[model samples]
Target: MSSTAITADATLPDAQPSPTSASRSVAEVLVCLPAIAADALPTVLEAIASAFPGEAVLVASSDPPANASDWPSLELIPYSNARTGVGWVLAVGDYAAAAHLAVERDARAVILLGDDTAPIDAPLLRSLADSVRTKNIDLVLPRFTLGPNDALVNSGLLYPLSRALFGADIHFPLPIDAALSTRLAQRLATSTQRLMALNQGSSLLWPVSEAAAAGLSVREIPAADIAPPAPPQDDFNALFATVAVSLFADIDAKASFWQRARGLPKRPSGQASPPPIAAIEASSEIHSMIETFHLAQDNLQEVWSLVLPPQSRLALKKLSELSPDAFVMEPDLWARIVYDFTLAFHLRTLNRNHLLGAMTPLYLAWVASHLRTVSDDPGRAARAVEITASAFETEKSYIVSRWRWPDRFNP
Candidate 1:
């Protein structure tokens, strides 16, 4: 498509342009920036202009700035259910809106950028677009270089669970910025529509899982250290519960696909490792986390009894006895804890909120143990995460069996 200066509303002139003239204005790439800040617009637009010079690029935003007229390629679009203060990842509404805009413009690819565009540079934008246009990847996720203490929830559960279940070895499944081909955008748009129909328009969309289920190819490009947005609420427990519940629901929805054995994608060579971080003394923090676990063990036993099997309960008991200095939650035990919780979620053993709330302390225990394990040598953090992920992969059969039978008679 040829490049042409267009208005922010994405409309043509009153005098209808011929097919040849209209084709010149058709966007080659539709870059969707949902709830992007006014100040960030210039940076994002500049990046796109630099990345794809001479290509017809359409920049769409839910809330375009008043000065959008200044940018000839801007498009003002409506994104319903746009969330405020909820992290940087694109919402379901954002995906649906982008898909609609892409189809309307007949774009070949779509790049979804988060609210924060400071970390997104021209090269990164080029890489994401090239992955779709040149490499033919259906879904291109960014693998951000995060510190050891950062994104613990993703490291402890999300990554491992997605890796083991979907056989997609994507480092960051829920990324703030990603590129999608037109077909993948359409697929996720249908999902978003269904969610909206069910009044779940505000729910998160697991693009990696969706792509995996659809048998689409996915690739991860290396990204700079981009910090994730803080939780909207101060209550960490509530935050963890929300994410865990959403992921568990997705797993339950795709039970049939994940239950079938599938080969994991090969890990890409020369993966970018996180930069070295200075270790900090976290004894008090670790002690606090462990104390919370001990208290949960004492008080939430009744709730736990309903969710955990006998062997898993016994394992927690053994973990409770360990001294703070020696506290360690084995990877296998942690994996089983996650699997059992997932089963409980699927079986509706109790109130889903309560079930997930009951898991916060256990997750804290794992985090505390993880901190101690890597505190001395921060560089070992990657290796430790690999061991944890491998444990989940090794124990996949455990969850599969429990899911198939769901009999409480297991040891």
Candidate 2:
């Protein structure tokens, strides 16, 4: 897969001049929308207009709306390489095209808005833009309000792993929308180009890891609940495997940075509480998930033996015996299981797909336990999440040791 160039389409006759043309007009902010439906463009444009009034804004889209000429302040630049409508996360091609346009226009800040932009409002847009423009922060990640059962994969593994490894307390590492300073955008562009050169152009980008590796400051702002795009495939196993493989590969790549001993950053004070979510009945779901785990325990012992240590395997055995009402997977035990699997992924203890596939039952088991815990007291959902992440931070030493000496025996 050779590296491909992202060329901007010519400006519409009625629209403003191209940002790359002879005028050389600078844009204060560059907002890149991977894809936008014709009907949704008005809402997006109206939000942008309200958020950034009387300022030059460069709007780049793979699918530009027909009425782009109405917004004189917005100079539309079209690019066609982005993998639009694939998923919520921005693809490598999207970042590459946005970076090219940002550099061309000398924009001070860039906002990468993934496919769904209808939910974004004026204040949210302003917060993302102002963070990069006023403050010196390099990356601004949005923390969306979610229900107790929502984003289980992220809550179970992604948030805790990233928080523990990168020392970033962001609730959502894989966000649909984010704000990036010019320098951070350039850095991401370089990384994307390198991945493209290696024939991994369609791979997902880890912005949090990139920012952490570059020693850039990061901040997470409260955002209204923005719904992520539905999974391209309905299979939960495949989706979990895909996300875990990407994250494990990222962890393996940044081993040097996270291996060193470091203090965890203190949580910000006076944070606003998230709005309440309606309670959901999940007893049936929990029972089904528990059954899945029990089946996997009986069937996948050989595959599990290759990755989990003796103690972790014993822990899972003990957990599988409990009934759904009595089931509870301790945070510490879950952390160790994840660490061992990550090590297995790094060492290639088994086929990567098979390794991640075996993890699905374990993850479902954890989810069942988590939902059971939070269902008893809905208000404790936030505290439960905090405790889970804290356990990961506490167990960081365990992973560091196993990573350094994979062959060493453990109890």
Candidate 3:
């Protein structure tokens, strides 16, 4: 999640404003800018300042370099929560602390950013800020256009499942960069601060779920051009476990909210456009993915049985029998498995960490099946992915039913 680099010719408006009277209420926006490489700070800072104006901006920095030191609006404070980190390599906890800072500064609009990807210009930031000011938008999330091969976990499970459950069509629910209206920011602060008090500041927070549960206004803006964030150092399994556990925990907490939510709301479809139709696996890695799935079936069948119903187990067994060259995990089957597993997680069917860990190989199986099926033109693959998401939406009733009665026999 990042913005395109700022051009040298681009200049921020330096025009300062006249002072407002003591009795006049000055409206301010909160800007949370993380430390980036030296050359990029000037452009980002200037853009933030320009977006808010002379006297109505409060910039929060964890420990900005000396180059950003001269900015008069900078509030360089050490946030303990900013120091929080999720296990392994997922370390994006800046949102919680930034929300707290926004509340402290009494800002009407608050933007939190990760150094990985940010907007280099003011217009996008202005667009988010204006939506908060005039359009009644409470949470402004950035929609990033990822490559077909990129962000597979999000493309496969996280995004689709989130959309199905929460009814917010935001592509990236936990985007590193976002703008939050005062109410939403305060809600985020409440979540993060509570985690800090419980000595779990390192735990993740789900803003989209929070907004949905509160029935607040949510909006999405395009950030397809932002350069990818700093590459993660963690490998996929640990990353999967960390993130899945966090999401499952959030779902568990918000079960009452999502279970009550009915049909998906009719709203602007802010999804990213279809990417170029090129095979993700022209030289396909289906073999390795299938191998992993096979290994899981052999070793973890007993564990999976506790979570999956007989029908799903049978589908998985059949998928297991398919040769690597002929492998295809159906979209509907995969959605059902995810739903069953989520229900199991909520029911505490087994060790939470192990439960999430077991999901990794099955996910890899889906990827293998996906790459093989889309070896031709990628348009077919995109359509298939859409079907998978639709399946999740269509199967929402199953989740609601099973969630309410975990011990009962379900399809």
Could you say which candidate leads in lDDT?
A: 2
Question: lDDT of all predictions, in order shown?
Answer: 0.76, 0.78, 0.68
Ranking by TM-score: 2, 1, 3
Summarize candidate 3's per-residue lDDT along 306-327 as a digit string, tens digits: 8999888889989999876667
Model 3 scores worst on lDDT over the 10 consecutive residues at 5-14
* TM-scores for every candidate against the unseen true structure: 0.87, 0.89, 0.82
RMSD (Å) of each candidate, 1 decimal: 5.8, 5.0, 8.2
Clash count, one per candidate: 0, 0, 6
State the lDDT of candidate 2 residue by residue for 317-395, as single tens digits: 9999987778889988999899999999999999999999899999999999888777745366776787778778889
After superposition, candidate 3 runs with Cα above 4 Å error: 1-27, 37-40, 50-55, 64-93, 116-121, 227-231, 265-284, 373-382
Relative to the true structure, candidate 2 has a C-alpha RMSD (angstroms) of 5.0
lDDT per residue (tens digit) for residues 1-411 in model 1: 232222222221113322343544566787877556677767666667778776667776655567666556544443432553346566675666666566556678899886563545678888898999999998998787767777889889999999999988887787677899888887876677665555554577889999999999899988765556555567787778778988999999999999994757535433323223235555888999999999999999999999989898999999999988778888889999999999999999999999998999999999998888777453677766777777788789989999999884444
Greater-lDDT candidate between 1 and 3: 1
Which candidate number has the best TM-score? Answer: 2
How many collisions between residues are there in candidate 2? 0
Q: Tell me the lDDT of model 3 at 276.
A: 34
